[model samples]
Target chain A: MDVRQLSEAVTEKTKVDTTARDVEKIISGLASSSHFWEIVCATQKPFSVVAEIIGALKEKGLVRVDQEGEITLTPQGQEFLKENFIAPRRDYTCPACEGRGIGLEKIKEWMQKFDELTVDRPKAIIDYDQGYITTASVMARVALMTERGDLEGKKLLVLGDDDLLSLAAGLTGMPKEIVVLEIDERLVNYINEKASMLSVPVKALKYDFRDKLPEQYVGYFDTFNTDPPETIEALEVCMTRGLSSLSGEGCAGYFGLTRTEASLKKWSQFQKMLLSKFKVAITDIIDNFNHYVNWDYLLGSIRDDYSFVQVKPKLNWYRSSMYRIETVSGFEKIENRPMPCELYVDEEALIYKPDKSR
Target chain B: MDVRQLSEAVTEKTKVDTTARDVEKIISGLASSSHFWEIVCATQKPFSVVAEIIGALKEKGLVRVDQEGEITLTPQGQEFLKENFIAPRRDYTCPACEGRGIGLEKIKEWMQKFDELTVDRPKAIIDYDQGYITTASVMARVALMTERGDLEGKKLLVLGDDDLLSLAAGLTGMPKEIVVLEIDERLVNYINEKASMLSVPVKALKYDFRDKLPEQYVGYFDTFNTDPPETIEALEVCMTRGLSSLSGEGCAGYFGLTRTEASLKKWSQFQKMLLSKFKVAITDIIDNFNHYVNWDYLLGSIRDDYSFVQVKPKLNWYRSSMYRIETVSGFEKIENRPMPCELYVDEEALIYKPDKSR
Candidate 1:
């Protein structure tokens, strides 16, 4: 079959946003690396969609998968790619900043100090779906905030402190005050101890976002940051809480969303919520900005049962793009209500399970 | 007045999102440069908002403006900045890529050819609000497309050819087809002449976006690109044209939006339309990605009447962030109808004048 016909068949079967060119690009990614995770990263597509694309290619006799599940393009696939002018995929993203367009040179000292302070921090707890980003990433976030004039005397809030972004912002000595609302008491106590010892203007309070925000925090903060669960319900609750805390009109919020757990449909829904329900303008969205270190529970989870992801990965495979949204005039204050237990698990979610205790 | 009180006052008076910290940031921006354009670029806020902030600062005795319009911090302003730990604003964005996280190294040869071909391109006419970006910016755009695998053997569409993006993409010897729908007859003839001479798979056709798209072109493209006039109505028309040309789900489109021309309220409204009406996912938004050469008519326009722009700018200051959106399941294509003359003129728009001929 021709390339366009094959791509059309794949799109029909998989029901994904796929083009003949993307089909060629996916095949080109497999030329150098048969590893599934590497191909996914190269394609910048969801693993589930990539898996289906490969299945269609195999059925078309353009690619083959051995018993070990290693993917390789067949002679027909190679010739098709050549005739279609599909060259080897090249990543030309800037080396210094990883395509975030911002680097960490200005905050080296603060980043070093943040690393030292959080070296003994708690590990990722699978129950909370908590996996923290690298300290350098946190520092990069601070540097961006500084560059955007969001730091230095701004009231900063962190809805979840597993990443310890509050401490990082506090270390810059830029913000007027940093408040962290973390559900994990362990993280809260840890942050409090460190803030007290270091004497930074930071405070940690234990509060689940599923509950109503305290009266004092309403319309009080200039910025809010969160890395919430990717489920629709979690995003609604978390984003609503972030909006409620803003003083109004130009208050900014930062959050992270991943393609691994959330489909593009969910992303569309989330953005719709932010724009219509919250009346906020999305200012920036840097792709793959937050690189997450693999947590301990990844290998033991349902992700292993997927048809792709053939081998155990030694690399940090999970990452989420960073998003910054700002209020223009005002935003709706979505009243907080107790969330159901199934707010974390959805059809596309891999590692999340219901936390019944809440 | 204290910093918080000053910020609150500024926010109240201007009805823009200003924080106590942002007031200090404005002051810090002024510490080194008194030029209005320089400060606006440094602070990355709207020009109108910055002008109001400076007015508030002057009222509060933190700054003074000379007859020539140079601004300087008062001793109390300096002291307030010092006491609040506000330092001189430093931009740590990566120097090489200018914080776009992508560079033009990969397409240097193609960029050179593009420049050589378009050396005698048409001058930007002010009535259509036409101003083209630098050649380097266009090359950087092509590189970003290459890195995203959107260029190779794809059916590409350019909604407007004033930027000559179709020619740039064509010179790469990629893309299965390139189509340009341009309102400017000069740009259309120029692009078609060059494409025929170069033997590139590109066609430029004169078409107004307010009219219905040609039936033959519907659902015929894999990707579309445009830099539309930043009015709410123009965005709707241009974006709908781009969407209607896409084959189906997984197609991508590129556009530009500038804060200088569109307010955050307009941005929020536009994003709402993109998400709800079109069902597209915003993948990336690189701030200040497209730097425009100062159009000849800028100094002769209403923008010169602003109080804060104390002196004429010698540097190129107009810029717009690049936006990339992709369809997921499917998108809605709004039918085109004849639009009004005021479609391009809005309260926030600075350079646009109605083209009566259309």
Candidate 2:
């Protein structure tokens, strides 16, 4: 009856959380939309997926199926569907994918190394107002760690390294230099402490993007990585710093962007802006690499700004695709829009639009 | 270490058994290969899947990885790869599909029901040399069972119901008439017994597809289903029989196909034949719907054929896409090239080409 519990359980059993939600989505969808049942059956295991929902609802006295296998929903079931199913999903599902764990053998070995040196999850600074969703700690590291020639002995700069990707990079003991530019002094101090303790050559600097790129840091690093705020302005700002950090040709940068907050229009514009201006060709895009924990801490703080704030993440529902970009020429810089702007809005802009229920 | 034991264990944990074989595949492939490690990091739970294989091999001192994460096969791993992996996979892998339980929720529950009515595994006739690979019986049945409008009281004809799809269909108790044309006498008798006892309106007839359509049976059925052999002739022949059985317009048929056995060139030709000649528009093709057991009996029979056949189905690797077709006009008959000849060969013809390893 509790779709959230069933969903998380399904994710553990099947490594597929979104499809379990599809059952509720279908039941709710059925109230207003009637589609050819075969459309639902088009999926890999529609029979089992549908049967689970039907059996659950039947056990709860909410739905029933006759001898002809026609499903009939009780009045109670209809009401439940209407109310609960109205909310859309906040995450994406891609199973057997590299991010979901169907990757190379040595990657598994390296990821275990990253996990072995893992630190406690950093506290989300309320002022930053960013979704602090994290996938497996070692998984975060694996994405960049497995980037062989791109990562090894390459001077790397991570903009707003909130998930501690720098530590992941440091664990490899391969980067020529690793720099962490952070607004939070606590994270900076934390990284500096771990870097020294682990003998990983990582330096953490208290930094903000509103200021111009530090002169010495300009075109200094070979690779940059960031999981920026989903907003285009913030993404542009962080990426600009990354671009500025790139020393020359063959330099690379990795950033995380999500389809939820950034629409196709936004993504198109953002991608165009990155490619056309910076000459950093988008080489690869890995889907659903960074799975997020509930950022209700930030959402709870946003109830004062928006009326439509009844919903909360009941499960790990947010993810960002990891994008790998390489510079073709000397990196071009984004024009400094140096307004000390309130970059993030209320929960509306922060949380992904639930309308795209996938 | 036995890869078979490891693969099944992995399937139990992740509902994905493909990754368990990647180690061997990679080892065998390495002789003629140079690759970036990221390729292996692309599957779900890459950390766990790859590690399992690596750890197993390391325990046996069968492989080694350089500090740079480049893998080098030990002599033992090379020998093992050559011996075991040479036989090639019997199944295909869809990165994150549901048939492996990565599917939607209802489908999983329904598959359980299909699994419950377990029948004794039937013997594969070496002369027939049909791969007795089975998908989840209830899962396959559910695809059509859930199609209430299309199936209820429909006159159904299955040209080669060796997987016992007829039994699954009969469980619906909705078909007005169902007939199976199977050369295997044991399966034919088994279905008749199961049908009579269950009061399902299905008749199993001892029929060879090479024969001309029987007079009473011609143009008598509304729907047809088959999993014809991948050979063009057999597929054409069985489909022609299915076309002949279709009573009139609005008739539909379902069949299973494998991308491995039927190459794109073959698929294109087959599709052209089905569309251009048969006049049946392909309505839908749900991929990886059928997972199969290795036909050891037929493969054992193959000892007289290929010398290299050590491969047992370590996991459910073989999958056939379920194709749904409906007659736009009346189903068109193939120009019958009637010949009294051996229709199918040994496992060499029935199984996929060993050269095309997954």
Candidate 3:
């Protein structure tokens, strides 16, 4: 079975509505002889496409592939594809594009461009694992916004394409416009495509915030949310610039990093700087694994130059689990709720909607 | 009221036994009129000595000074001291000896000698502020130790001359012997003097721990307490080598730096390395300031670092104030126990007797 066959199978089974070209590019990428299993493991693609792709490869008689086994492209199969197949052209896959929407690729490209301008040049050191596990942490911010009635008809600008922010936008479902400023174009496109597919009104903007922001967007957003940049200086600048762009009595929700002494110090400094401009009403340090995941990989990806010494007395799991948040001016904390146990539940369980009437 | 009269007054008032030489050195240092106030501010000396020394200068008509003031030495007094007194005795008066104890000059020389030996060369980065706070933290540690029944007649070996460790030795009053290892011979001598003054049973040992420890003391200590060097590699080597020298089931209490992401990674690696030998237990990350200072400093000195960040949300004070402690391996956690509060009072309130009879 080939990409065409896999696409046909997915369309029949899931009604996902994807073109044969799109399926071909995705499958061919997966079927590349060099470490195909790793690609399958890393990509968060739906299960149907994954199964169909694998099934097609096995059925072709060109390769003996196991359905319940790890997928690897055989040498003969690799040669057959190279000789006979015309490689499907790769198009920017917009996550916000639902069912072949117009301008999906354009939006994806725009977000990609923005991400190139923003995240690619300088990597933000983030604990994606912690962010993955601490899913309930975002609820604190959302609750605050809801209590203040800021979510209704409010233009919320989410800076960074991390899953937390995307999930947050999907859950809250109140912001008049949820604009995502992302550094990875592919991620922006992916999120856009997902949002479009799900009928979530989230827009992806690809822009490097390090440089001066576009004048057209000045004062365009009312509320801002950011996962702080890695460097202390960059974080400070991001906070200042992000907050400065807010209109009216707007506030920014900072997913401030608070793990290491250095990060804590930076957060403290950022807080101090922000306190001068806005009034902080609520601050919490909580532990909720649903909000974050892949902590080991996140910490490893960020290059830390400072040398630290470790003293192993005993493992105190409770103390290490907590994280903190501070609510800025014009926002009031609604409640202190415990983290939900099932974080990776489907979108239906997690999507939050404020009052329908703006 | 010249230097002689002022010396006599101090001796009469405090009944602190001080030789004429000690009085003269202190008085002259104060009356030198060259950045005298800065020196007085920097040195951790008694206010009485500073007052008397200034009083003597005024009485002698050596200089006109302000009593209701931060002491300032006049130019006339400075010139007289430089030409007639300071130059001749500059070499004799040790710079390290601040007259209160062996001065900075002696300590510097001792540090130089310590450097010559290829041992304990990479000293731990001791944050003076954190160390100041640790004096109370150690008290809290003692409270925990008492609760654990780990503090009876056990031989407690203190590897560094930390003020907290010294105070812990004094307050517990149950250790078989408290041996303090200090690389600086002068500091060891000074600490010995302080211990004697306090009537604390502390034995000061001048030794570089990077090299092999003296065989006479090998495996002699039951409980090892030290703020170990901070680097993971150094800490691992130190803990392995130092803890190995302990008797069976003997525990070592190490107070060093807190964990960061890098430190956590390093610690995880260190734990893996030590898993074959030691069964680790007990870890606490205490963040409350009240857990480190009495009401005085908690309200005063610590007010400098506390402030709000308006961007991130704060935890609701009532709902979020409670913190949890869980059992990791061998020990059960005390319930409803808040983070250590009343650092000075509650920590010392518990009486500890180590199970030496076992």
Candidate 4:
């Protein structure tokens, strides 16, 4: 009956850190939602931790599982939540910006132009683990960049081009130069062709991150942007390349990290790398800022088997938190070293699958 | 005439890191506003760095300074920004949340109730270097806490409550228990009286952060919030005491940090402590999230003589970014050992005077 006693039981049963507050939070999450992903979203906890918490709750007779893996709190659980006075969370986030301070309204014209340019863009290739965010997201990103004083009159290096971010930055006519390094030759050629046609002044080069950055571009950029693969190896490469390109302290970098692909442990490691290894001060991390469109390959991909996909999400639930970090004193450069072969798939990967043929 | 050449000259003159991008950003900042504080906000750079950059630009004949320390671009600087297409940053942030992604609309009713409760609250004491934020800021903070799943049915601790955050949070009727540790007895009495009359479960104890945390409350909280003094010593104490109160991994902490009082070096130190020392993952850092009302003692304070205060800021420019950090596997508990006597005064002390009589 006591929440702390129940929390202790859950913690002991699962061998995971579960606080008295977490027990109530899980119960509150179940009041409106019965699916695993919904609970995860409501609690904002890691997938593994949520799984453990649910398992422990079920064992305690606080919740019951239905035929489709949907979970609902029992009458006993509801009574406990009421006794504790825990209310279900209400959606209070700004609908216009989705809790991101900058909206797409200011960049409406740019989004229209960008939409037209990406009409025939190449589909996300599984081999490269490529998935691009929406055009409105790209414009919002550009707006954020300008707001942070990172966009205007800066040499920007886009570590990948699947997102076509170089074109978006170039469209502002603000950055002095916009360069993109992408392994996909098709994307490189397409971006180059588009840039040349629109006179956006973007240069897209075919470059794999596994290789060392070219000598000419070392410490050449004022800012770098990347949406690296979720694997630890890919993170290291993207970070190293991005750090190596930044000129000095006060230079900035932007990247996107997703909870769907990277666990809280991975997020911790990424933060450690930024703070301890590179010595950059993370200035801003806006959650769910980058929303990805459902890729065409989702139906046949390994993600189809994910528990959350029992009923395909009707909304765009695939999102990444956008991170903006600035150098303080200086940064330590990480070299491009040989990495493990498996950079596309990790234990927590939900949407990405390995290309066996490659 | 070349921007890169000018940037190199500025670097040589200032003996500080300066990039072409910074040069352009400074020029662009001047295109809109001429005051030093306005430029600092516009560029989002460090105080010392902005001072050095502006001095270098003035020496290079790029900007002209008037008697009141207001700066404007010279004709050459204007021409350079125009030729480089460095547009002045436009105000595109959401007016509702001020770009924090959460607005005050949902909490409007709560704000009115909170407003009535604090009608006769004690004014901030200069001896403690205390200043309170707006009521809307407090509510937005509570909303953000709920959004992050940190509030409901939780044992919450307010480390320093000059802002009376305990009352605002108590108004929600969500937190299981609200405990405030404040050195200001007037504030403690005021908060306790309000909470008691409203049937809100809150307890305020007069406790200074310099002393060790009481044994009974250590590791007994689900969340802790604080707005510490700007000095490094205060930061460590607040962090240590807050960490000591957290139950275990997955527990969260919230705090406010400002650029007006802390430089980029201090910001870097704070990040390293969170990531390297305590090993916590910073989840969200919303810039300019907490706006403070101007204090009553500004006329006689040392800040009155600051370069940016010459014009007497017409708007509320004092603000701090809100940080939400979650524990990873575990955190290294920092002991609240003896701290330095001068926790209120530092090299960047802008708003807080040392109170020599003490």
Give the whole-model CA lDDT for all candidates, comma-separated: 0.77, 0.55, 0.39, 0.76
Clashes per prediction?
A: 3, 37, 66, 2
Off by over 4 Å in 3: A1-148, A250-252, A261-267, A277-282, A285-291, A295-358, B1-358
The residue ranges of model 4 lying beyond 4 angstroms of the native Cα positions read A1-27, A35-40, A45-72, A83-86, A299-308, A332-341, A350-358, B1-26, B46-71, B80-86, B303-308, B332-341, B350-358
**In terms of lDDT, which candidate is stronger, 3 or 4?**
4
Which portions of model 1 miss their true places by more than 4 Å? A1-25, A55-61, A65-70, A80-88, A303-308, A332-337, A351-358, B1-28, B52-61, B66-69, B79-88, B303-310, B332-337, B341-343, B351-358
CAPRI rating of model 1: medium
Tens digits of lDDT, candidate 4, B1-358: 6767766775565344455666677777888998876776766554445666677677778888887878888998888777877788666687776777886777889899989999998987677888888887888888888877678788899999988889999998888898999988898888889998999999999998888888888888889999988777778778888888888766889999987667555787777776666857788888888877767775466433335444555556678889998875546565655554566656554435534344
- Model 3 clashing-pair count: 66
* DockQ winner, 1 or 4: 1
Q: Please tell me how candidate 3 rates in CAPRI terms.
A: incorrect
lDDT of 2 at B190: 85
- Weakest 10 consecutive residues, lDDT, candidate 3 chain B? B315-324
Locate the minimum summed-lDDT window of 10 residues in model 3 chain A: A306-315
Candidates arranged by DockQ, highest first:
1, 4, 2, 3
For residue B210, model 1's alpha carbon misses the true position, in angstroms, by 1.7
